[model samples]
Target: MGDQFPPDVIYEIFSRLPIKSLARFRCVCKSWLKYINHPYLQTIHRFKEEPTPIIFQLVPSANSNKNSKLCKISVLRVNQLGTITIEKDHVLDVPYKGWSHQTPVLGSCNGLTLVLYEKTPWHGTLLTLINPVTKQRHDLPPVKLRDTEWDCPSSLQAAGIGFDDSTNTLTTVFVLCKESFWSPAGINPPLCTMVHRLGMSSWREMPQTPALPICDEGVFAHGRLHWLSNSDGFHSANDGRKVVWFDVKMEEFGLTDAPKGGQYGQLVDLNGEVGFAYKDDGIHIELWVLKREEWVLRCRFDLDRPRHIDVVVCGCWNDDGDILLTSNGGKKRLFVYTLKTDDLKEVKLDGRCEAYIRMHRSSLFSIRGQNYK
Candidate 1:
């Protein structure tokens, strides 16, 4: 009765196991490879209570020593109310061959995170992606840099990751600017735009690039990579921030005017739609959803005297429709604000607040009209 455990039965049982265990079970049989990587199983892997990604902070040595860690990250566990009850669980070993300054993380999509590793004087820099759950780290090919060319930075510039729905594969995108040493039009900023797909052999440079230079890392949403850009460089007095996006399916770069507001803002997912959350650096805060290149104001709040702390809109916590806000207090005072009920909670975790926070968007919608085991 070996056939009693039919292929369908085995898949049902295997898909429900923890992601780490399911990854190991893939080696139980060569045929399991196709099943474990199946779209359905991958979606199921994301539904776990974990994945409220906190910054894995790496503090450098204060002794002014020559050698120090680039950065440390935090491991967080979810509490009963689905808040981040920060705890140390795993240490991510990043494979880089340079100083602690070389390991600036770009961002995280799904369960994967992209970290930039600077190469030795012999090598340039490598964009590496690591899956914290599976502990599978993949490094992209080294980016070639010219001796006289100024270095193109990734952290403050632009770095992002997203999924290509067409290929059903996750792709990490990196944009590097080539310095125009001579004339204004001599070189194109963000001249080198590259994409590295998971399980791929090498990186692929794109033919087109964004016109404006990216101000920071890309925020992935709606199957696209979005970043705030400065058309006139960061020094311009009227440095009107614009939203630049790369369509994974079309492989095209485009830009639009960001919602008119303050500099303290971020792009977050609003009920499966592209959302913009901003604070005026005062008591006023606004939330808007993208509606055909225009923004529709969804929510606005004005905090009172003592309650009006610098709040950063992170994302919607759960199905309760409460917006999550992290007060910009020092590391010692980690403030959490729930918008719906005007409730404030202090997250006194051991870990520092990560620069980039990614939401978990898991669904089994991809399995429709597909063949399965």
Candidate 2:
């Protein structure tokens, strides 16, 4: 009867299992392992037939050790009844022993998270690419720039992670500054941006990218890693800011102007589309979708009540079309927004602790449509 169930059917069942169960079931037999690791099965598992919503953690107070330990990393499946079911709680095994409060989780892509370690005298700054579900991690080496005389300032280092499917490579980009602004006038200083590819073990300097303005945030989407940059007269002359995108496959950087009066908020991938969020009047948030090479305002999320303050959007679409946003001002709440219904729902968390949430394939069969395929 086991043979009667085709491998595809078995794969469908296996993909729904949690990561821990898959880890144990991997020992079922060599055939099972081989079947799970099959490239075709991996792709099927990655692109789900239906969309799903996951949780995102927001750590309010970084200094609280107890709160950090209390932070639970889990995936919840929301049903039609608006009930959430926990699929995997990563904190059960993954330790958070020496995690400092200042460190922030940059984001996750392709079942991996880009984590930034807070600055320390001895440790400069470190970017860790980790898979909480698989418990595998890779620490990217420091960035190096050419022809520039600069000391690596621990505070000035910024790093982000992105996956290139065409090359089957995970690329980590680190930006370095010339030096801390020591001069009183803060005059024209020598600055440079350096990118380090993960597997290559070397750094390449971006010369064309300007040094006068700084980037605020960076996120990976649509085969490139994008950052928000202020061009000439960005704030003073025009509300126009440039979207600087680095094509990982080509190792090239280029600029694209955002919509008029559209201030950059967050860059994320929504349902296979490159999306940007812009804050309007400090009250409402509008999401811009890239359609046919044009940026269009697709959806608007309004924060009507006075208590609905200080909203921060993070986490792009999973295999499903749901996006997660962490909202907090007076109180803390995690919201899951659905693209289909245009509905926003609050998720019930374990404790008030600040948490970092990421989505990972629970089973090998869940690998479909990812870079591995």
Candidate 3:
């Protein structure tokens, strides 16, 4: 069979398959394993659209009764009709023993997921990047603070990972802010933005953009990391702009337009474009996708469920128009909203203390590759 098909054709076929199938096919032969692990194949796999039904959930150690430092990841599969089945589960144990803080945020970028551990007032922050498919993890040292004299409780506010097109490498951006005692006075304590290349041992500090208060996690799309600006005053009365974005390629921060008349919503990656989905009343959810710097109303449908305080879009779009979402206030269940039929169904993941999930497509991209750093 190998002799019948050219190497390029075989590589293309392998690249088109799902990550799980690719993993199994690697054991077929040494040549196939080499092809699967090749950087070219990995890059192709990363760029190609994978409408896989796989979902990745990051459960903090605090969420479970266990007291281990390992990060547990649950892999779930959803059928076209929105039925979820637990495919497998695994834990990532960081070999470094410097810190044991609980994990809080899980961000995805170019086939890799970045996990940020909750930072204590006395300890520094530790970040671990893991490829769940490959079971490979890389730990980054504690973030270096510019001003060590600030006695306030400093913590990670928001974090995200993106690809730097200019450098042809992966970059992560996170915001750290010192706690302010005078909340009534509306005094925002200084914030420090940190940037780190994939293979770097240390993080470099980026100048703070005060107008954009990144209080939420970032959604990576179109070569930039975007967040819903926490500051309401930054939005114009007429323009309705609310998003603060950082360019991974240019390494700059800027503002963008959000959906007009939107009361509250979260930023999501609709395939490769920026998407915003907000609740209209209680069960009515409206989806707006960004195209050519304009917000286009994609669709609006009722969730057919009880009212939720917050609606978090899974951002994983399938060919069948199935949208997965989770509520900020609920029983920690998954709501599959089908746009075609305007039906919503709930799937209960038993014993899930936290609903930290992201649409994941695994790849064989090596974390310790020579191209990094």
lDDT: which candidate is best?
Answer: 3
lDDT of 1 by residue, 25-90 (tens): 666776676677676666555545433534545454453654544444444555655664655555
On residues 60-92, what C-alpha lDDT tens digit does candidate 2 reach at each position? 345555533222345555444456423434431
Top TM-score model: 3
Backbone clash numbers for all candidates listed? 9, 6, 0
Candidate 3 ranges with C-alpha deviation above 4 Å: 1-7, 21-39, 47-70, 79-103, 151-154, 178-188, 208-210, 232-241, 308-310, 348-353, 371-373
How do all models score by TM-score? 0.75, 0.71, 0.81
lDDT of each: 0.61, 0.56, 0.66
Alpha-carbon deviation at 332 in model 3, angstroms:
1.7
> Every model's Cα RMSD, please?
5.7, 5.8, 4.3
Q: What is the lDDT of candidate 1?
A: 0.61
Error of 2 at 85 (Å): 9.0
* Weakest ten-residue segment in model 2 by summed lDDT: 364-373
